[model samples]
Target: MTTWKDFLVSASTDAEAQFDRLKNRLFSRLDAKKPYKIVYYRGFGSPTAVWITGRVLRERDLSTPSDNDTFWQNLLATYQRFESDEVPGVTVRVDAFGKSNTAVTDKEGYFEMTINPPDNLPPGRAWFPVRYSLDAIVQPTGEPVIKDGYLMISPLYSQFGIISDIDDTVLVTGATSLLQTARLTFLGNAYTRLPFAGVAAFYRALQSGPVTTLFNPIYFVSSSPWNLYDLLIDFFRIQGIPKGPILLRDLSFSPAILSSQSHHTHKLAMIRKVLDVNPQLPFVLIGDSGQQDPEIYTQVVRENPGRIRAIYIRDVSEDRRDEDVRELIRTAEAFDVPMLLVPDTVEAAEHAASLGLIDPDTIPEIRADRRADKE
Candidate 1:
């Protein structure tokens, strides 16, 4: 049991320490002439923890803050909710890298932080956590005020990339069933998302590896609608998935366009955009076998050859016949790119780590099912 003063005092102290740690971390990693911005997000629900996630942008060449045209802004409005007794406030602690700083949300549930580049701040990736408390009090129920959560800010480059898929890949909204899909698209909210088990653990494992590594440039290229971006982000945060750019398709596209266009093509286009900007680095691709991932990956392997080092496909429906699976196997063999088919992301990651793609001692086990061939 904790009192109001106990909550306030503890929260304030923690917030201050978190702020200072973030400020110092950023200052140590930024250059004086480079500008950057931080975006904060808060989740709403019963005793839900609020999180701040943002990327830092820096100019390649030394540019004054006044001359720098690019700055950070929210793609969607920040969200907040007040129970009968919750209160919110935000404070911007420092400003460098253009609009880099800290801010607390007001009663309306909005907050912004800006910063200017510091001369001593080095030129590399940097991150900081925004910690705070929510204050609430219940009358007869005796519920206390002030819940605690965090906001995370780290530097990101436009050249960084990510590749993901729809259906059973990112969100488990039932891509195979039209009725289920309609329900998910129409009535579903963030809570409706059912992330494949072990996805969060796998993502965190990948992020924990070496800096500026091969898979650093990441993105989520899904056939799912852009409308679900917020939901997906919240899902990833709750599940502890690494944050990066997310590319979503238009759910309202023309029938001809939607039918004629392969999701693989859209994903390839996104990958091309990332490669066009950063031509030197390879990419990481993640997808599922519920639809046309095998066909798409086959084409990608043929076109790019060695651009993709590894490909992981979740085996959801198990609809691919023996011949089709064999063909995909041959395609992967031709390029020397390791293509994995796993029951879920966990098993896929286990294969990846075993192949030295990630560093984790304990790997998830794949359940073996013994069945005789009838034919």
Candidate 2:
């Protein structure tokens, strides 16, 4: 009699067109008794998507192939619709890979694959490489999708983390100017957002690290509207940022009251909450110089100075000649935390590695990749 593991091996294949059919057939053979959780992440205008299906292993006699076979089948079925959503007039193909399997996304930008690594597969790490592409189209709204035509499925770590901003930081479009700030506060989502370049890369790199590392937990605290919570999550997912709790400003509180607090008072309050909940983990804070990052980080250093090992600030314009920059320098000086000013993410990563915050061995490789792209 063929074992369940043998059936799973036989079921693994590379035909993207047959992914759905194969998944369905395999799942139908399962008993459907095991509980599974379906997790998914998608990015806008990018051909990247992530999904994981797994059932919690309880102490049960799974020695029989039938017992475990059904579980695998059910897990595979859950991932079959990876790219089935229709993006009008555009066809997307998702390329998916497992240790022993490969597949592609359908016209609707979906793909499915089964991951059944050998039992000896390292217990602490799980990675999947996925890629896809689609024709570029300008939506009626005039938003253009740039197709770079590069397909790469990197080793996505099973563990991930995130640290984000608020106000114009993660929500809305303006953070530095007073007029735009008023608009973002009063109108909310109507203000729109222009995410910083290389933000997606930063998040993906953090996600690719080992789950048990000090920086694996992703964290975001912003003064933006809490109503945009789901939208932000989807944005990060589609962009390949790891998923984590987003701490947002409670609009229910009076704006006047909030203003009375320090510039970073609200963000600092939220950061404290994050530390309270996750006491031992270190965090990489992502923010812009326009608003309260420097101020909040200053306070964070004073309070739990050890928790934040790296802070990345995008150097947008500010009255640095004035007291703002001086104050930030003073705060960082007090903590002995090296504050780096960078035009983009690549520079930030380089600085971090140089400071021994991240692995130094990886910097040359990342720099080379940057050069290749530019050439």
Candidate 3:
């Protein structure tokens, strides 16, 4: 049953794709002699197969920012991020565990593939390096470009997994308001962008779980564009957030902007994929009430049933949205998953400790960190 809205979205999506193809063709012709690089996003997998995503783009002069960087420098870096020179139709080869796979970049210069190893990987949580090499024909004037991308393989049996959102959930992007979001994004560097109070401590505790060595995997699934990948990675490092596979969406000119429901489609699919790959592992879902996270996470609980351990939504919106999420909490409770809308990380930490998801002794550390972050 395709509604009128669906038909309109489909037609607009096609038009946007065609426009992107034309634009990419022109850029490819104009930037033939430019230096290029392969930018890899962190990937995740189990013992049998690995999933990876990356992009090939003409290199820009964006450098690491210092604390004293001028406003102009931040603005320029932001511009370079959005002014991407994507290289389409280039062949990329990925090799790991004595096996190899190949994929071609799409018009948006992005490539994704899943490769199964010849044999099962050793059972444990660790990072594997996947070597990526570009076809020489694309860069005929110089040596072939090669880079290593990392894939995190979680243990077959663990306490649980965590899937979280980025923008307003952990990092403060003021996502509910376009003007504030733009102000923060355009003028702020990794050092300047702020994460919610005590997010680092809370996420670290979750990663370590009740036992410090558990190494429960954490995944970030966000609706943010792929262009901000490097900035987000740097921000995570600066804030001491646990690292894992970051699932982001392409910044294509799609009809997604016109429909609120389309924003969470990518996020939901990515969360489901993570759950599907780790069938034996239950998960904790985390997001915020600023957008459609409550609605999306409720759907996840309904679909996965026993697979979801709990849900924690950070409260960042108004009373109306709070009530909306409260109703969603009731809806999720029907599936036996405890869903809480917390005003801060402390509340979530308390509930998680009560549930034995994290160690109770870590509560003091969380409080100290939260207080220090406010300074």
lDDT order, best first, reads 3, 1, 2
Give the number of the best model, judged by lDDT.
3
- Candidate 1 per-residue lDDT, tens place, 1-375, comes to 987755665666667557545654674465443332223233110111112322222223122212122222111121111001111343424322333335554432334333333344333443333333222312223432222333222223322233567567866777767898766555444444466766655655555442324335355666665445556666677645677656555333233224446566676675565445444445556787777777777777787766776788877664545357567967887899777776666577767667665665534321111011011
What lDDT tens digits, residue by residue, belong to model 2 across residues 1-375? 987654544445224327645654554465233222111232111113223211111111212112233444433322332222122223333344333233433332323333332334333432434343333433334443222211112222322224677444434356667787654333322113334555545554554443225335456677664434444654555444555556554332233323446346767786776555445455567777776677777677678776666677667765553367556756776777666656666797677656545555555555654454344
lDDT, model 1:
0.49
Score every model by TM-score.
Answer: 0.54, 0.49, 0.92
Poorest stretch of ten by lDDT in candidate 3: 135-144
lDDT of each: 0.49, 0.47, 0.86
Query: Over the stretch 179-270, how does candidate 3's per-residue lDDT look in tens digits?
Result: 99999999999999998998999999998899767888999999888889899999999889999888888876567755766687888898
As a TM-score, model 2 comes out at 0.49
* Candidate 2 accuracy as lDDT: 0.47
With candidate 1 superimposed using the best TM-score fit, by how many Å does residue 155's alpha carbon deviate from the native?
8.6
Off by more than 4 A, model 2: 1-162, 166-172, 178-193, 210-215, 253-258, 319-323, 359-375
- TM-score: model 1 vs. ground truth: 0.54
- Per-residue error (Å), model 1, residue 339: 0.8
- Using TM-score as the measure, the top candidate is 3
